[model samples]
Target: MNVLWIFAHPEPRSLGGSLRDEGLSALRAQGADVRESDLYAMKWKAVVDADDFGRAASPDRLVVGATSKCAFETGELGEDIRAEHEKLAWADTVIIQFPLWWYGMPAILKGWFDRVFVKGFAYGVQRPDGRTARYGEGALAGKRAMVVLTAGAPEATIGPRGVNGDIGDLLFPLQHGTLWYAGMSVLPPLTICGADRVSPGQFEAAAAALRERLRTLAIQDPIPFRHQNGGDYDDDLVLRAELAPGRDGIGVHLDT
Candidate 1:
């Protein structure tokens, strides 16, 4: 299987980096064709600006969405973004490995999404009926995505009643809103909690868990996030009253 491993850790010797190495080794041993984007090592550009599109000469104020859409369609996107697009296109599964920062992804990774996943390529797409094709259908449909995160907090703290909140809820924006919105089937994430204090034993356990997850990456069932237009949501894109009637949070979007 073709796999794209997008790693976003600055330190090659850190826990996150160690896991990335272990995961890659396991994937290769599994006979998977793996391509990796080591963001920090590449010194990846971490901002979206006029430089992303080739048509910066236009007199119109840079409408990023429209400009990016045009650039993507006409092959005018920057080489770096195009290269990433090509890599993504070649792979059926994308493994995003990063340390969760501020309850979200690192700036470089977020910028990677901002710059690479352009409007026409990843969003601002629609179906033939003129309805939006996102949250379940879009250009990236049929692909699978998985996140491998390392968070500083203890696992218990990220549970349902923990002060830091449930890990699933914290990741909904990326898993459901972005990945699923872009039409990828998001597999359940592999999270290494209390990373700073991980013992040798803990590291071994985490590595084993990651290897198992990687081995089953292709056939594993994706997180059952409800589709935006799958009759669970209304014309306005709000979840129908009939579904999750009593719940009123991001967790309600899950097909649990």
Candidate 2:
């Protein structure tokens, strides 16, 4: 299996980095070809610019495909973005590894998504019916994605009555909206809590668990998300603009 691991911790010695290493090692050992995007090491750009859309001399004719000349012309973007896109196309499973910061992904990783997931690539795709493709169908339809997040809060503290609603809620946008919407089957995330005070033993356990999880990627069924444009909601838009609905015995519904 080809796997793309996008890591987003500033410190390579941090707990997040260690977990990422462990996960990568395990995936490699399992015979899965792995490619990593180290945001900090790459000094990745956090802002999107006009050049993201290939430049067209004629203002009215600006198109979305990656032009060969644009790749050499766009200073900020290099072969790396194309390499990432190729990795995404090649991989069957993708793992997003990062430390939870301010209830969301780090700016670097978010920017990676914003830039790498481009128009004519990630979104704005078409279907065989000549209709706009929905969440469950696209260029990335058969792929699977899972988040391996580390947080400073304890698991209990992130529960229904705790400071955070639930770990699942915190990741709905990434798991459902981004992955599922991009036509990937997202698996339940494997989150490690109490990151600040985790013991060596706990860390080791977490690594082992992650390895086992990666080994079972093919057999593990993905979280069944409701397809947004499947005519289930009004006007073919997300029921809650930024929230995913929850079904009984499925997962948490942040809006509820």
Candidate 3:
């Protein structure tokens, strides 16, 4: 299995960093070919600008979507963006490692997605029959993605009935909107809660859990996110009322 790990923690010696190291080692031991984008260490530029497309705005206004599409299709994008695309293409699995900040990933990682997952590549794709190819079909149809996150809150707090809300619900935007929307099957995330208070035993447990998750990367069944074009959704991409009858929110869309 080929895996690409995108790490976004600012400190390499921190808990998140240590777990990332352990995870990568475990993947190596499993004989999986792994590549990584250590965002902070790379001094990754987190902003999306006109430079990414190598084009000057004709009316002095940066046309981001259009520029990205043109640059991606014409091979005119800067080296960094293109390199990331190449890595995604080469890997069958993508693992994102980061600390949860304000119930979301850090700014740099969010910026990475904004810049890397551009149009014509990550989105704006189509099937040969002219159907919109996403939420289950697209350029990344055969690939899979998983999130490995650390949260400072206690596990209990993040449970379905906890004050912080269910972990699965909290992560819906990333899995359903971003990863699955790109056509990659989304896997259940590995979350380490109470990151700020982990004891030595907890660290060991976390590492062991991470290793097991890695070893089963190829065989584990992905989260069953409802496909956009699947019969569950109507032609307008809305969920069929009969299916979730009076249900709403993120949980209602799960096929399980």
Candidate 4:
């Protein structure tokens, strides 16, 4: 299996960093080809600007979606963004690792998606029927993605009734809205809680868990998110009334 590990953490000696190292080693040991994008080590740019589109964008007004689409189609995206795209294309599996901040991914990682997953490449794709291909069908369809996150809070505190909210719900925007929308099958995330306090024994357990997850990466079942064109939703793009009736919110989107 070919894997692309995208890591976003500022400190190499941090818990998230150590887990990343462990995860990569596990993948390599399993004979998987792996590539990494250590955002902080690379001093990755965390903002999108006119330079991303080059001459594809208008000088006076910048519409991100339209301009990015133009740039992607014309092969005018920034070199760095294009390089990441190439990596995405080459890998069958993608692993995104980071420490949860303010209940979301780090700013740099978010920026990576904003720039690298441009309209034409990730979102603005269409099918023969002229319908937008997304939420299970797009340029990155057939690939697999998984998120590995570390949190300062304890596991219980992030559970169903925890103050911090369920980890799955907290990550819905990313796991569902972005990765799944781009047509990549998303595996259940591996969340290491209580990151701020870990005993040596606890660290070993976490490492073992990560290694186990990687071992089954190729055959593991992805989260069953509903497909847009799979008849789960109506013509207006809303979930059909019969499915998950009376239920709403993020959970309703899951195929279950």
Candidate 5:
């Protein structure tokens, strides 16, 4: 299996880096081909400008997603984005590894997604239904993805009633909005907590767990999220969650 691991940590000698190395080694030992996108080491560009489209010379082409017809005319990128896209195209599975910064991904990693997942290629794909294609059912469908992250906070502090009020809620945008919307089957994430003061033994355990998880990637069951166009929902179909569980206006009963 081909796996693309996108790592985004400033320090290569940090705990995140060590986990990355251990994960890579385990995947390789299992005979899986792996590719890495080390953002900091690559000096990735953190901003997205018209120059990214190779048409910056034309002032009129400075619009985002305006490159609907703009092909990759120029074979130039700052090496990082180029390698990332190539890996994305080649991999069947993707593992995004990073330290949670400000309750989200590092700026560099977010920028990577913004620039790499472009229109016409990543999204804007069309189907025969005349509907805007991709997201729920598009080119990126059928692939698998997971986030293996390290956090400085203790696990108890991010529980449903903790200071953060559920880590899952914090990750909804990334796991559901981004990955699921893009048609990738996202597996449950593996989050290692208390990285700020984790002992070496604890770190080793986390690394081992990650390695074992990667080994079973092909058989992992994906998170089942309601499809936006699953027919039971509508434009105004607010999740009947608050009013009454499993109740829908269209007589469709959802599993609460």
Candidate 6:
């Protein structure tokens, strides 16, 4: 399997960093072709602006979605963004590793998605019926994605009834709104909690868990999110009344 591992931690000696190293080693050992995008090591830019569109951008005003769509179609996106796109296209599996900050991914990682996953390439795709292709269909369809997250809070705090909220809900915006929307099947995330405190034994356990997860990357079942065009919703894009009736919020979107 061809894999792309996107690492977004600032410190190489950090827990997230060590886990990234372990994960990559595991992938390589499994005979998988892997590529790495160490964002901090690369000094990745974390903002989007007119420069991203080049000649495709409008001088009068800048509409991100529209301009990005035009730039993507015209092949005028920035070199950095285009390079990431190339990696995404070549890989069958993608692993995004980072420390959870303010209950979400790091700013640099978010910026990576903002720039690399442009309108035409990731979101603005359409089917023959003129409907938008997303939530299981798009340019990146058929690919698999997983998140390797680290949190300073204890595992219980990130659990179902924890104060920090369930990890599943905390990550819905990414695992569902972005990755799944872009057509990649998303595997259940590997979240290493209590990131601020870990002993040698704990590190070994975490490493083993990561290694095992990678070992089954190809056969692992992705989170069962409802597909947009999979007859689970109505014409207006609302979930049909019969399905998950009386239930709402992020969990309702899951195809349980």
- lDDT values of the candidates? 0.86, 0.75, 0.85, 0.88, 0.74, 0.87
Predicted candidate 5 versus true structure: per-residue lDDT over 1-256, tens digit per residue = 9999989999989999999999999999999999888889878887788777553233343332322322332245445565666787789999999998999999999988887766544555555565554445655777899999899999998887789657777777787777776678888889999989989799889998998899899998877666655653455645544434545432222223
TM-score of each: 0.92, 0.83, 0.91, 0.93, 0.83, 0.93
RMSD of 4: 3.7
Q: How many clashing pairs in candidate 3?
A: 0
- Each prediction's total of clashing residue pairs, residues at least 3 apart in sequence or on different chains, is 1, 0, 0, 0, 0, 0
Clashing pairs in 3: none
Kindly list the per-residue Cα lDDT of model 6 for residues 18-102, writing each as its tens digit.
Answer: 9998999999998999999999998889888777755334433323232232224435666787788888888999999999999
**lDDT sort, best first:** 4, 6, 1, 3, 2, 5
* Global lDDT of model 3: 0.85
Output the lDDT of residue 74, model 4. 33
Worst 10 residues of 6 by lDDT: 62-71
Q: Candidate 1 or 2, higher TM-score?
A: 1
Model 5 — TM-score against the truth? 0.83
Write model 3 residue lDDT over 190-252, tens digit each, in one string: 999999999999999999999999989888999999988888988788889998788888987
Error of 5 at 24 (Å): 0.2
Better of 1 and 5 by TM-score: 1
Pairs clashing within candidate 4:
none
Residue 225 in model 4: shift from native, Å? Answer: 0.5
**Pick by TM-score: 2 or 5, better one:** 5
Q: After superposition, how far is residue 186 of candidate 4 from its true place, in Å?
A: 0.2
Q: What C-alpha root-mean-square deviation, in Å, does candidate 2 show against the real structure?
A: 5.2
